[model samples]
Target: MGSVLGDLLPLAVGVAISPIPIIGAILMLLGKHARTTSIGFAIGWLGGIVIATTIFVLVGGAFGDSDSTVGAWIKLVLGVLLLAEGIREWRARGGEHSTPKWMAAIDEMKPLTALGLGFALAAINPKNLMMCIAAGVTIGAAALSAGSNIVLVIVFALLAATTVVIPVVAYQIAAQRLRDPLDRLKVWLEANNKTVMATLILVIGIVLIGKGISGLA
Candidate 1:
């Protein structure tokens, strides 16, 4: 169990390390929008990974072999889901005029809009979902039975959240600190929102496509 926990920490660290620079920049530049968007990404990443991984780790390991052919079907379904997500996000690349999913609907947003936005972004992401499946498969195949290992999976998820959320918190703090000078910057972000949204969508799409293809391999 200690060894498994050790392995999980490093993977979480690796994922956190990947987007700290780019995503961090986006947060700092985009300000409040970045706060909401990053939260969305984390929600999507955690929700998809944890739930999907839980399903496999628990059910697959208990009822059948972890190495069963069912994994291919799982991967295939995950791939398709991610592909659709990539396309959806891609379509939302431009400004709000181009797509409704670009950012929080400023006009329609209520108190819980931020939370809803977070769930939607995370849930719609296919690549993150597939990644979770891969992680679950790895854990299930090597570790104790799913019934016994459920807590470990949950713990790994907490660690994963910590990894992703740290940078977001840092970015938000920095953004808040810059509020004076960046108040004007918000106007710029609003005017240039299309550029910011497009870039994120493109990067996300490329990542998903690559991962989906790897799953096919």
Candidate 2:
């Protein structure tokens, strides 16, 4: 179990450092329903990854063996998609852009609506979707007991949810002092979001392609 968790740590880290969620959480923290909204968002974010990974694992098991070749091919295609996205983000990083329109209205949203938004971002956003799928593929292909497999999936979801969880908790504990630092982080992430995402995606893509080839071999 520990070994499997160790192997999936990179994916967890990638998901944890996801900028949009961090930024969105920050925005929610500064809103009227800061605590409730942020907490709901965090729950939805965690739930999204958990639900998506669970479905992938169950579907993968139903379709074929754990180490099936189809899984390898799926990884290969996803790897290529990641690489393309990386290149696109790299090229677009240099352009001047306005803040996303959705962000402007975030402060006005109720907690329940914020929860749905959080789920959508984590579950359906292209970059995040790729990472979750990659993790699912890895888990689905590994040789492990069913119990261990589910445990690792839980760990993945928890680790991936760490970043968003921190700010929400800290705000609940010490909003005044934490505000400056959190705001600084939000500003920095917003400024370098594309560059950070491009680099991480490219590195992960290369690794996935190598893993896929090795699996196919």
Single out the weakest 10-residue window by summed lDDT for candidate 2.
58-67
Candidate 1 ranges with C-alpha deviation above 4 Å: 1-48, 63-100, 104-111, 143-148, 162-164, 171-175, 178-217
Per-residue lDDT of candidate 2, residues 83-182 (tens digit): 8999998999989978887789888888888889889888898888888887876776665679977888999999999999888988999988887887
Number of backbone-clashing residue pairs for each candidate, in the order shown: 2, 0
Model 2 TM-score, all chains together: 0.94
Off by over 4 Å in 2: 63-67
Minimum summed lDDT over a 10-residue window in model 1 is located at: 16-25
Residue pairs clashing, model 1: 44-122, 82-126
lDDT (0 to 1) per candidate:
0.49, 0.83
lDDT of 1 at 150: 79
